[model samples]
Target: MSFTQKFYTADHHFGHALMLSETACARPFASTKEMDECLIDCWNSVVRKDDLVFHLGDFSMGLGDAARVESVFRRLNGRKRLVLGNHDYAKANVIHPTLAGLAWDAPPAAAMETIDEGERVYLSHYAARTWPGQHKGSFHFFGHSHGRLAPFGRSRDVGVDCPDTGYAPRTFKQLVSGMDLEPIVAEEAESFAP
Candidate 1:
């Protein structure tokens, strides 16, 4: 399918009841059904049928079966590429068939590095302190933190729960504009380890 733009998002946690609890992401919605529909609407509101989306991870959970998961996946707009999360696994390290059958632009991966419009973008389901090209102007984005993890160096969480992402997919330009983008220097990283 043809695409006009690229967007990034993750951690929708559809059908996952724990996501509504205060100990979890504390989603304001009263129920998973409400959260799911709102997430789908938020995605479709900014994403178009021809837009490409890179979902970092945790797309769905507790949906019972593949058919149910597929039902939700079909409602969102865009051609999707997924970076597998801990929840996406079925067993023996295999992705669920329903996700595999979704006509993804490429095979779902645990991590990926791409050249986008002459810029390098690295993607994963979890954050990293330093990535390939951290000092060469490359950008690294990930999800899975649900906004709990703070931005570190050139990488940051792109999960929907993050305020910067605004509970929806975001473009590279929009994400980068809010980033410091300063090259990581040796001695710049600090650790509390004894």
Candidate 2:
């Protein structure tokens, strides 16, 4: 059986610690403390008590960093799920209470099964391309590009990253009917890398 429910996602970079400050490649964050503060603030601000959060990926710097962040996530009240990202690999890593479990380099299609049939919601750490044909009917919610996509219009689905950011979440009906997500797409990340 498939389940459908309201979902929210935050990339929760903990201030992007596992990354270099000025470059695109992966590296440790310069200010771990500051990043932790911002991450907590952002996550607390958006998540409600009953809200289901699908943590798209990149939850922490690595296995060593997991305990710190996991403690924070555990304290915050909500239903959670995780789709392991590239940055999550390491020892001493503890999984979140609601995590589906660790996923190394699996394709989103395999993960798609975790989502309910015909459920319009999605969440992820990075942007992904719209599936073609039958699979194209669902809406995809993801992060990773970090507030970089340019806004095209309201009707486009190609660019909208988060639901609360002004861009609307596309419904299953909209995608299948061939409605214009041009505005969504125009502002969306250039390509869905994974």
TM-score of every candidate: 0.90, 0.53
Q: List the residue pairs that clash in candidate 1.
A: none
Every candidate's lDDT: 0.84, 0.44
TM value for model 2 = 0.53
In model 2, the runs with Cα more than 4 Å from the true position are 1-5, 15-20, 24-30, 91-110, 113-119, 122-126, 132-136, 149-194
Candidate 1 lDDT at 118 equals: 73
The true-versus-predicted C-alpha distance at residue 132 of model 2, in Å, is: 6.6
Candidate that scores best on lDDT: 1
Error of 1 at 61 (Å): 0.5
Estimate, for each residue in 26-95, the C-alpha lDDT of model 1 and write its tens digit.
9899888999999999999999998889999888986457777888888999889999988888766888
Using TM-score as the measure, the top candidate is 1
* Residues 1-194, model 2: lDDT tens digits: 23433333434555354444555523233576765555456555655566555555655554444456556656554566555555554434544332323332242221232343334444445555543121334455445564454322221222123333432222234322443343234224345334
CA shift of 112, model 2, Å: 3.9
Off by over 4 Å in 1: 1-3, 185-194
